[model samples]
Target: MSQISVVFHSGYGHTKKVAQSIAQGATAQLIEIDNDGEISEQDWETLNQSDAIIFGSPTYMGGPSWQFKKFTDATSKIWYNRGWQDKLFGGFSVSASLNGDKQVTLILLQTLASQHGGLWVSLGQLPSSSTAATRNDYNSLGGSVGVLVQVPSDADADAIPSGDLKTAEAYGKRMLDIVNRFKK
Candidate 1:
């Protein structure tokens, strides 16, 4: 089976919840970015072996968390060696504010992947734009970028919308399907 690696930094539990759903659906390994802004050597090895990599982080102050940015910087060594060239790359982010410039965060991730010569993959699923679709519809416009979960600053993990979680799972599954096809 083709391996997939998800590396992310989550300040609150919202992003972590989305990452877990992605891992579950893709059967991919989850690598947490440590407080020191480093991934375990073993996890780095897994990324080297994996067919795809999915990045996650919460949008903070119009960008991704500092921790995630540090980790990305550290990957420069890998990039020099063309380590991730041609590998599938995807990303997700969460924010407390409705328009927190989450797309900027995704663009940052895409740029990093491009710098490493990786192939970027967007949320392949389209939003249900029909009037018949409700706010809770799966893969809605707001659900783009794997799962852009929204939670009030004071809200707890329990407050996350179920729709966001479901969308994340589906994103993971879709990523795996692409990985499997490319492996063939």
Candidate 2:
């Protein structure tokens, strides 16, 4: 079996819920960046030891939250040494708007993984875009790079759509499968 880790920062609890759903499906460890945009040294060890790492962050101001960015910046040491090279990587982003420029956040994550010479995993799920498709359907937001979750701005974290959570779970499963397939 391969070990996977989900490292993320949740500003308003919404992203944390999404990370939990993905972790459930991936059977992965969760490393949360605290409100101060810092994670423990143990969290860094977990990430370094993980066979696969999935990054999650809520999109704020059309990009990943500053907390997540701080975490990303802190990974420079690992990046410089190519510590994550050849590791499998995945990412997800959450936002309150249906088209909240979530793709930009995902690209930031993908690029970060690429910078460390890690393999990027695409969402790989076809979108639900038909006229009959509803918000409760998987990939209703039609994301291709990675998982995209949208919660209404007025709604609480608990009000996240079921479809988005399920999509996150499925993506977790996909990442696990890929990790196992490429395991040494």
Candidate 3:
């Protein structure tokens, strides 16, 4: 099995819920970026040894949370050494609005992976965009670059749509499958 790690920063617990779903499907280790945006040296070691890495963060304002950005900035040393090079990389983001600029966050993650010379895995799932389609359907948000989720401002993390959670899990599995293929 491929060694996968999910590195994420969750504010208000919403992003953490999504990360859990993804980790559950990938059987990946979860590395949380704490409130200070600091991770232990062990987390860095785990990332260096993993076959795949998936990034997760909440979309605050128009992009990823400041904590996530801080964590990414701290990865400059790893980027210089190309520590994550050639690994399978994927990402997901959560926002409060359907069009809350979550794509910007995903793109930032993709760029981070690219900077480290890693290969990216797309969501590869079509949108559930039909009269018969509902929020409970998988990939209802129609994400191609990575998984995208929307949680209403008044809602708690538990209220995250089922389809979005399922999509996150499936994306995790997809990354694992791709890593297995590529590593072989």
lDDT of 1 by residue, 1-184 (tens): 9899889998878788889989998999999997677888899899999999999999999999999999999898999999999999999988888667788899898899999999887787777678887546676546455567777789987776776777788889989999999989
lDDT of 3 by residue, 38-150 (tens): 99999999999999999999999888899999999999998998788888899999999997999999999999999999989999999999999988899998889999999
**TM-scores, all models, native as reference:** 0.94, 0.98, 0.98
lDDT of 3: 0.93
Backbone clashes in model 1: 0
- Pairs of residues at least 3 apart in sequence or in different chains that clash in candidate 1: none
Clashing pairs in 2: none
Scored by lDDT, model 2 comes in at: 0.94
Model 1 off-target regions past 4 Å?
Answer: 130-135, 143-146
Q: Cα deviation in Å at residue 22, candidate 1?
A: 0.7
Put down candidate 2 lDDT per residue, 47-115, tens digits, no spaces. 999999999999999899999999999999999999999999999999988989999999999999999
Q: Model 2: which ten-residue window has the lowest total lDDT?
A: 152-161
Which 10 consecutive residues of model 1 have the lowest summed lDDT?
139-148
Q: How many clashes does each candidate structure show, in the order listed?
A: 0, 0, 0
- Report lDDT per candidate: 0.85, 0.94, 0.93
